[model samples]
Target chain A: GQQVMQIPQYQHVQEGEDFTTYCNSSTTLSNIQWYKQRPGGHPVFLIQLVKSGEVKKQKRLTFQFGEAKKNSSLHITATQTTDVGTYFCAGFDAGNNRKLIWGLGTSLAVNP
Target chain B: SQTIHQWPATLVQPVGSPLSLECTVEGTSNPNLYWYRQAAGRGLQLLFYSVGIGQISSEVPQNLSASRPQDRQFILSSKKLLLSDSGFYLCAWSTESYNEQFFGPGTRLTVL
Candidate 1:
């Protein structure tokens, strides 16, 4: 079975600090997707990386896929109170019944 | 435009009671639908997914079962719920298996 491991299960940072979460897969992945869930809300899709060694950014958030396609990371700069949420990374393995392997996720807490 | 709908934003059930949750997608045809569960302060756990009507693939083996009677309708049911069944259930739809998913607001179930 394919598995995705995420690091820093929980993180607490000041309002102006930066935060990063990493995701690693046991096997090669066809693509990786990132999502965010607020305190009491459902997960929302943020972005997807399909190419190897790819990087994408949304304002203060940056996402990168490893060259081997086995790992990925999401970094947020100058966190805000609104950035408090759980961030999840899901990896799509074409060889694994076409299902996405989800990570345990990293919960981010920002202090104002 | 596309939208996903889930009924009963919140629910409370006793142990051994039967459970059913409904999810539907609008403005999409033959989209890939998925059911996920998240315990408090935990990550997303995929329960089931459907590629089309009557086609379902379950990820986790538990007291839960899923059915797709229509192309855009997905249902999660349990004959008898347990205390462990208490969690937030989310429904999501994607244009393809590897594409980004759009999630519904989700249903919170508390099993007593």
Candidate 2:
């Protein structure tokens, strides 16, 4: 069974601070995706990285896939009150079913 | 524009009770559908996925079953609910050859 692991299970920061969360997998992945879930809200697709060593940005958020496609990271610049939520990374093993394995989300709390 | 819709934003049931949840996608044809469950303060877990009508693959062997009767309609059912079934259920869809998925608002199920 393939599993995705995320670090810093929880994080709290001031509204103007920056935050970063790491995601790693037990096996190689075909691609990786990032999602954000606000409190009491469903997961929202943020971005997807398919190429090794790829990086993407959405306004204040940046996502990167490792050169080996076995790890990833999400960094938020200048977090705001609205950025308070959980961030998740999902990926699929190369030889397994297409069902995505999700990482335990990093819960982000921003203090104004 | 494709949109995913899930019914009954919240539900509460007792153990051994039957349960059904519906998810339908509009503006997309023959999309891949997925069912996911997320426990409070945890990550999402893959439960089932359907690539087409009457075609389903279960990721987790549990008390739940999924069916896709139409191209855009997916249903999750359980003959006997358990307390552990309490969680936030989500439905997502993606187009062929593309991995980015769009998620619905999700259903909050509480099995007492």
Candidate 3:
């Protein structure tokens, strides 16, 4: 069975601070996706990284995929109160293209 | 434009009661549908996925089952509920051409 693990199960930071969450997979992944779920709300798609060693940015957020495709990270710069949410990383198992493994989310709490 | 809908937004049931949750996708045809569960303070867990009507794949063996009666309709059902069934259930959809998944507002279930 494929598994994805995320670090810092919970994080609390000041509004202007930086935050990062790391994700690792037991097996190689064909692609990885990032999602954010606001408190009491549904998860929303953020970005996807496909190529190894790939880095993509969306405004204050930066996402990176490991060269081996077995790990990834999401970094938020100068976090804002509105950025508080649980961040999750999902990976498509290389062995089973149809199966997507989800990491336990990193819950972010930004305080003003 | 695409949207996913799930209902009822929240539910409460006694132990041993039957359960049913519905999810539907709009503005897309023949999309891949998925069901996931998230316990309090945890990450999303893959439950079931359907590639088309009458096609389903179960990711974990639980007291639950899923069905796809229409191209864009997915249902999660259980003969009898347990306390462990209490959690937030989410529905998501993705097109064949893309790997990013769009999620629906989740349903919060509480099995008393």
Best by DockQ: 1
Docking class of 2: medium
Best-performing candidate as measured by lDDT: 1
Between candidates 1 and 2, which one is better according to lDDT?
1
lDDT of 3 by residue, A14-100 (tens): 999999999999999999999999999888989999999999999999999999999999999999999999999999988788877
The positional error of residue B111 in candidate 3, measured at the CA in angstroms, is 1.0
What's the lDDT of the predicted structure labeled candidate 3?
Answer: 0.93
Cα lDDT of model 1 by residue, B43-112, tens digit: 8898999998999998878999999999989999999999999999999999988899999999999999
**Fnat of candidates, each listed:** 0.79, 0.67, 0.67
- Chain B, candidate 1: TM-score: 0.99
Q: How well is candidate 3 docked (DockQ)?
A: 0.66
Interface RMSD of 1: 1.2
- Using DockQ as the measure, what is the rank order of every candidate, best first? 1, 3, 2
Report the CAPRI category for model 3: medium
Model 1 Cα displacement at B110 (Å)?
0.8
Best-to-worst TM-score order: 1, 3, 2
lDDT of 1 by residue, A6-74 (tens): 999999999999999999999999999999999999899999999999999999999999999999999
Q: Candidate 2: which stretches are off by over 4 Å?
A: none
Cα RMSD to the true fold for all candidates: 1.0, 1.2, 1.2
State residue A38's C-alpha deviation in candidate 2, in Å.
Answer: 0.5
